[model samples]
Target: MFWDHRLTQICKENENLSKYSTYEIGGLARFVAKPRRTEDIVLLLDQAQSSGMQTVMFGMGSNLLLPDHPDPETIYISMRDHIEVMPRGDLLYVSAGTPLSMLSLFGDLSGFTDFHFTFLLPGTLGGGVYMNAKYFDNVMCDYLDTVYYIDLDAPGRGIQSIHVDDCQFAYKQSIFQHQPWFITGADLKLKTTGAAFDFERINDYLNQPLVKESIDNSSLASFYRFYRSYLSSLEQGNKPVPEAMMNVVLDRTGKNHFDYPSCGSVFKNDYTIGTPVGKLVESVGLKGTARGNAMISPVHGNVIQNRGGAKAVDVIELIKIVQEALHKSFNFVPEPELVIVK
Candidate 1:
């Protein structure tokens, strides 16, 4: 293959696509290439485009679902090896493939504590930037000074630099997300503090008893559902409720020993409903519901998991069922967080 000779490492006819993803469920890739350098990536893209092969660029594969039956015409490009980082004054030029968790650790070690939240996330820099990914409303776009991307549609395969404002960032979306632009790197503007930021204190805060224990146990996946449930109760004027609903969901779901597969929250919150979707899910009996190797996380109705050997179709089916149920019950449609590869 062209990639074999041109790139540092390239695998053809690989069937272990599931291992690369957090969900741990996927079919084979006809071609999976990992270029050692950025230039090699451009070369590979050019070759793929010319050959009329469909390409999917992936970072850490945190938020994607590959079909159970592989697409023979498609090639998967792994950007993990293209990791690069350069500190230019107060800004850091980071390759899209860099893991957010690693970046967080880097910041902590380098005494850049202001950006510690980036580390706790389970995504890559490119994916984060693309989604304007955020926690607590502190989004990636807020720190991005500029972004460098490859235009797949242009003649001669042009590269473009986008300013922060031009990205059109919003809740879990960016302009680059819908286009054929392949993110190369990002310029992250960070702040420095006079006193060294206390990594221990921050770690303690992140590892709070309630939050840490909930996430540590898989059964507690329903913690979000409980949170939504409690919020709903509050809205409904319910008083004297148990204070540990969140903890219960977390502890119960964490004990599940099924296949460690997930698409995170398979549904997005519907804003028009004026009430959180989690509350609606709890109202129905979908929480902790299970079907052939697939279950609507009893902890959280929105999260679906593969008990073991669950197919992408199965997850999709559960999502559809949930959407229909919600629509029938509350006249609302829940959006999926997982992007299905058709």
Candidate 2:
């Protein structure tokens, strides 16, 4: 009865959790909360602690999977869509709630060039910094200055600010992943060249038909060369990669990912393995393999797709099959990147 007063102020019980994930394949979460204010988050955490309820916080649910059967006693917190952006001098102070899409655009609009690397990622700043999200050579930690958190493991429930260190990172790993702290915001350091590109013209040029690859078969080289030169000039003058260019990267990499309900990549890249697990999966001919509605993608071996009406158990089973095949055929052991929320 006591918990009802505090918790019910921001949480809803027996939520359909499938709606919250990119995979769209989760069962009901016992309770779900989206706290718009920082104080609301503190209060929720406090009440959960007092009531002895286990709470899990996630950003966009892009890289997570729920358990086959979840405990109803658990509580889920989503910081996605709770966006706020503020500038401190030449750097940026981003709320964990800010979505990556908005964050990247904000930087471009504000004439910050280096911040464009995260322009097309699928989650919020909370998950971005927590996981140290990366694209190409740039990772969140590369620009991260400090992380702000509520110390659940510490006495007095302290809000701590910690700088990034080498121990806090690995290939798709972070300290927050193993700890009980909740990240609320981050301070990032990025350099800008000063704003000078005429983005309106860039936008118009991007919308033209000649920009399409098929439009200039013989002169494709010239078009691309000019485009590259333009982008280089903008970047040198302190401007982001054009939105159209980022769109190209997005379109190129997003292949078959949005085709169905599935986490983008089921397995993490192992540095020592020397080969991408996707290529290995293909070599073993496990594509299009199925366990119920869940199956390994024919288009991409690393992806496990929910063909339709897939269950968590179905995906879990498929993962086991792939794992077994990898170990047996290639003597390679695979590790999951997804957070299975059982």
Candidate 3:
């Protein structure tokens, strides 16, 4: 009853959460608040904070692996449509709700001429900036000039802006990830890769029969391309291969677990540990492993798939199996990167 009626302006109670995430698992959110304006968001946050309900924010839901039914008392926020982008002279102003792909596409379409949108955004700009989302070698913070964030409790500052340096950006992490604040937007002073590639041409190229034949999602050809790049990275003294990526072995043997619904990668590519997490799972031979309807992807050791009607507990059980196996074999415990909530 803490939220009571204060959030009536911009909140919907018991909105189903399953459709919001890319993983497409989860129960209803007690309150799925979509505040169109800053004040609306503040008021909703205040209602939740004052009532002591747990809160979680999500964007595009590309990185989340939520439960079949989350806690009914918690508040879920979706900022996907709350904000927009703007062009102010040299700066490309980005709002948190803006999808990364939108921003990049805008940059390309706007002929920002000098700036080439390089990062492959799998989700929203807010999530990307929060985690300093990375693709291959590029990162979210690399082109950022300034970031604007809202500290829910700080009404006097309205929204505060921090320079790129002070934003504390690191590999796959940002200050926002640690700090208690919501990123509102940012100012990006971008650099271009002169003579930007024609996106339409690229799209046309992708539509080519040869290219389409080369990339069979059904057959895992795309996965193989990624795996090849990953292996090439290691061979050419490039960075270590991403553990969650489907293995080249699977590609060579024509194996793909993509038939089932999956959350792609389940764990982060942590190198501080001795062996890679995926390798540890592979070492213990947990690939193609199953728990209820949730199964560890056979082709990609780090992936966990939902084989229809899978419960969150099933995935949790599979994760525990991998963790336990790794611990038993290599004495290492892998950290889950999925945004799983009870």
Superior candidate under TM-score, 2 versus 3: 2
What is the C-alpha local distance difference test score of candidate 2?
0.70
lDDT of 3 by residue, 63-162 (tens): 7777676787788887765654555566767677665644543443444433223222345678788878765556778778889887866534457888
Compared with the true structure, what per-residue lDDT tens digits does model 2 show for residues 124-209?
68777777787767787877778888877541475677888732876677888888777888877765546433344434543456
TM-score of structure candidate 3: 0.74
In order, candidate lDDTs are 0.66, 0.70, 0.65
**If ranked by TM-score, best first, what sequence of candidates would result?**
2, 1, 3
Q: Is candidate 1 or candidate 3 better by TM-score?
A: 1
Of candidates 2 and 1, the better by lDDT? 2
TM-score of every candidate: 0.78, 0.81, 0.74
Query: In terms of TM-score, how similar is model 2 to the real structure?
Result: 0.81
> TM-score of the candidate numbered 1?
0.78
